[model samples]
Target chain A: MSRIAITGIGIITPLGDTLTLNRQALQEGRSGLSSLEIFPTKYASLLPFGEIKITDKELKTRLDVTEPGVTRTTLLALHAFKQAVENCGLSASEIQLSETAFINGTTVGGMCLSDALYQDANFRETGSEYLNSYDLSSVTLYIQQRYGITGICNTFNTACSSSANAIMYGARLIQNGFVKRAIVGGADSLAKFTINGFNSLGILSSAPCRPFDNARSGLNLGEGAAFLVLEKEDNVIDKPVYAYVSGWANSNDAFHPSSLSDDGEGPYLAMQQALQVARISPKEISFINTHGTATENNDEKESIAMQRVFGNVPAFASTKSNIGHTLGAAGAVEAVFCLLNLIHDEVYASLNFDTPIEATGLVPVTEYKHMRVEHVMSNSFGFGGNCSSLIFSKGQKAQ
Target chain B: MFYIHQSSCISHQPTFTGVDLQNLQPSVNNQLPAIEPKYINIPLGQLRRMGRALRMGVGTGITLLEKHKADGILIATSNGGIEDSITFLNQIVDYNEGRLTPTHFVQSTFNAIAGLLGMITHNTGYNATHVHRGLAFENVALDVTMLLRENPGHIYLIGGVDEISVRNYRMEAMAGWYKKEPISNTELYASETEGALPGEGAAMFLVSNNAESATAKLADLKLLHTADENLVANQFAEFVRDREIDLLLSGESGDSRFKRYYTRCEQAVSENTAIARYKHFTGEFQTASALALWFSCWLLQNQTLPEHCIKRSGSKTAFNRIALYNNYQGVQHSFMLVESV
Candidate 1:
């Protein structure tokens, strides 16, 4: 099997919009959780979210989007997509090649404009502009059309583990010789649909989420987009490499629709299988970017999973404490953060973690420190008992 | 190559419980309802909470899994649980508060089918959901092909499910995706219609690398997107040029706008190749091509094509090889070949 390298990275999170800014914020242990301001909702004052502090119009202006029915989700996706393709400096011809593929992960898609869609369903004499944007693939289709990509395009929706699966699937395509290169990642925008959904589940926190903290009540919902350009080692030898996608595994808990099993069987199997695929022992994993959603079920279950996998957990942290849980984008966003960890040789703090859980007695890395990181494992567990883990190993530097 | 160990479909046709589809009638209503499966010992509480999409998907999924066990599960959905999602969104607007029901929200996700199937089957292996508009089923097929290549000899249960709702149907109707005039299903192809009749259903396949117990062999498949008829013709020629095709199953959804693409396909194949259509029976959705695959397997297994689906009969009586070609609104095109074991 050929090695897959992460040649380009792009992100638009609450911490910062650019890669440099996000890395700097991570180094400084800064939190982006704040009260929702741009969008109005009943929980605006009560809940904190990692909202990307930019207005839709401003984002449109920045991305030069003039389309009529573009959703906020599409804008965020376009922003990150542009940065990723440009980061790799891929030419237009390269992007339009049939050998290339674009695999995007998203939960919201155009459904964020639910109110408009509802009206279009009720009173519209003609078709509403939002009609074409309601499905989950609309964002990806929009990007494909904008870039004139003729290759195979797909959209995945496995909840929080969606993007991680996208990355995994992309690598499989290359490894299997289905495609030469694939641009894979996910994006999600804040909307009333998710807010109401998470609120109904009673998992939305009123303050910044406290991952792995004993007093942690629930998770804070957030929104962002992240994409990584993945290419075969041979295809990207001339370009700069950020990290190598060494291993990935996806497993289901077969337990619950919205919560994980008590023993963390899903997370355990995912991490164990990922390590097995990487051909590395548990102790070889340097750090872990955990899927610490700060929920009553997720944190403790993830802690138990870590213990089951490594016996002694590595220096792991949940960037969710900094950027809240980004839903479908959590995987790719955290993957980028893990790459940052490998690139900078530093471990970012899992903010708001004051105490460890009683059952597992596991505490995350709470302070930023320079560590000789080699292999970092990133976990993304989603609703429907979907759990996925990706192992990104540090690539050899150009001496 | 992938081998189909077991297959199940819950569609408008009488496909459940291994029933014969000879008595199927031409549908008149724009919306064709799928036949609900009879659940035996499964949990009723969980089934009751599921929407039509989840029920159809899990119903067919469990059916296939019970017959042929699988280690991995992959599902494809186009719109996916639109009824539940629209209902949930409506509730949010109606109440406009944080206090709302969680069931609809829980089931509104696109992966609801895959997740529910995982929970029900207790298969903790690879699980994924693909939601690429018209290429949903094609993408799932591609993923399964790659997966079987990597882990040769592993069994995988892959499926495609899409549910239709009034809210979503209305949006599509407003967008003019459906025909304005309701024509008889039998007359769909002859009516010179501009849009297709909306439909939804679920189909599951138990695939494996082992061919010892295979019912039919999946030869190969291709997916493309273009508006050029000549390019489609060339691709179709390349796909069928090497194989001695006995029957050609074309996705002629009765929409004249995309009729040229199918016409190009018809021109690409040999004159003796039998032609058939299924959109009139299964209606049209993103993954309706799955229904085509199921139809192709049925033809190869039974060695005959139902008269209703036959557009042009050929002299070949022995159905050894069947090819499926699907075109979605002239944007997404896919080709799959299935042959008898």
Candidate 2:
């Protein structure tokens, strides 16, 4: 089996853009939650979210996107991806472009553009030319065109598990000898469609979400993008490796369309497979980045899965409690956080974690702790009982 | 090798339970209503939550799961829940993009159907939903094959789904994806036209490492993304010839440009071999070729072909080797070879 290496990482979350900024926020237990003000919506006053402080114009100017009228999601992707591409310092034109696949995961592709057009008929007529730009394929097309990449391009949309699967697919493609390198990640911008959808489910917390806490309500919606440059160990020899995508697995509860199974079998099996693939025991996993949406059911079910897999719980936390759930971007964003933990040799405490669930006595890490973290497992479960787990191990020469 | 234990599809034709290729009836028009399932027995709450796409995905997924009790589920969709997506988008537009309905947002997701299937089957095993344009089904199928080959004790439920929406269809038509003149789907293969009728459906199969009850053993599957027609034809012919294929199920979507590749495939087959086309019945979409896979499994299990599938009436040879050739708009070419157990 071929080993997959993470050579580059980029993130644009509510916490901040750089890994250092994000780590600082994590250590300080700072919550990015604030009254929704980025986009003007009727629910703005009612729903608080982890809205980013940067403006679209600022992001576009910073990213240097030549195309005008791009969707916010695409802009976010470009901003973060450019940083990752530049951070690697590899000449884009020199790489084997045909062998490098672009795998993007997102829940909404340019729906923000459609939202703009739909709300204003005048804007619709004027922006009619941009309609083609709203198609999901346009995002990949833009990225491929900008980066001059001609290899396989795909957009994965499996809800929140979308990007985790993208990461897993990138690793598998390298292992399967289909591609030698890949740009894999996900992006999603806040839209009325997502905001309203959660509200209808009655899972949207008006206040800041307290994941795994007795007073926890639900998740605060957020938006951002994150990407990772993954390559085979042979392709990036002697390079400063970020982290190793050692093991990953995807599973489905097949329990309910919108909720997880009470038994937590889907998540449990996913974790088991990830650990098995890494050839490591549960005790070897030092920390976990949980898919703690702060929902009553999700917190409870995820706790049960943790207990079943580890017997004794490992130090774990939900960044969602701080930055809120970013939907399709959650997996990649959280993966970046996990990689940051491995690099910084630290564990982030779950913000707002006050009490353990009565059913499963799983207590999340409540404060930042300095630890020699070796292996960190991150979980992302989505609607329809889709569950995915990824294990990011500290960088080490391939065995 | 991964073996296909069972397969089912709910399309416009009466082919869900099983149909004879020779007895297939021609579609009167290009537009055919989907054949609704007998879901009166299904719970009301489940029914209420499901839209057309979700119903199609879960219905086929459940059918395959009930037959094989799979440990993993892998689904592929090109534009998952597009109908719901459009509805949600329109809602966002209607409310001046105000309070977005969470119901529509959740339903609008591309993996809505896969998630629903996972919930219904209680399958907490390996689960993934892939979307790769025309190669969506092929990618999912490849993953299933790989999983079955690597893991000794796993059964995978794999399926492909795509739903067409009015807005999407209109947009595609504007993009020159559809022909100006509407042609019946049943006559799609014989039309010699440049475009195929737009259609949507779902196909699911149970793939297992245990080949004890397999209808057909999947030998190999490959995907290529080259636009050079001649090279694609040569690679495809080499693949089939090397495998000693006895049958070919081509994804001739009634497009004139793509027909030449299928013609080359036919020329490569032996005089005693049989050939068939299935896109006429299933319509053209990213994963429509999955339906053709169901046909191959059916042929292997029943040892017969319906007249509607036959292009050239060759002698009935023993059904041992079969190959599936598929492509989308001259890209994402895929080849799959299967043999009787």
Q: Which prediction has the highest DockQ against the true structure?
A: 1
Q: Which stretches of candidate 2 lie over 4 Å from their true place?
A: A24-30, A35-38, A52-70, A89-101, A116-138, A141-154, A176-178, A352-369, A397-399, B23-29, B95-108, B186-194, B226-238, B255-275, B301-320
Give the number of the best model, judged by lDDT: 1
DockQ-derived CAPRI band for the predicted complex in model 1: high
Model 1 lDDT per residue over B1-341, tens place: 69987889988888877656665656757666777777663579988888889888988898888876688899999877889998898888878764998999998788888988899888898899999988988899999998898789899999898987888889888777888896777788886868888888898999987889788888888888666788888999999997888888989998889998888888877888889888888888888988778777777778767778889997787888888889887778888988889
lDDT of 2 by residue, B1-341 (tens): 58887787877677666553565545545644446586543457777766676777778777777666777778888778776777776766666655554665676577777676666665667777777767778778767766765677788888888876666666555544665577766667777666777777888888887768778887877776666678777877788765566678888888887888778767777777788777777777877877778778878878776777777756656678888888887756788888899
Write candidate 1's Cα lDDT for A1-399 as tens digits. Answer: 679988989999998999999999999999999988887777788888888999999999999999888998899989998999999888889988888899999998888887897687666778778888988888998898889887888899999999999999998888889888999999998888899999999998887889999999999888899999989988765777899999999999989999999899999999999998899999999999999999999999999889988898889999999998888888999999999999989999999888779888898999999999999999999988889999999976533
TM-score of chain A of 1: 0.98
RMSD of candidate 1 to the truth, in angstroms, is 1.3
Candidate 1 Cα misplacement greater than 4 A, ranges: none
CA-based DockQ, model 1: 0.80
TM-score of each model, paired residue for residue: 0.98, 0.88
How well does candidate 2 score on lDDT at residue B138? 78
Q: Give the native contact fraction of candidate 2.
A: 0.58
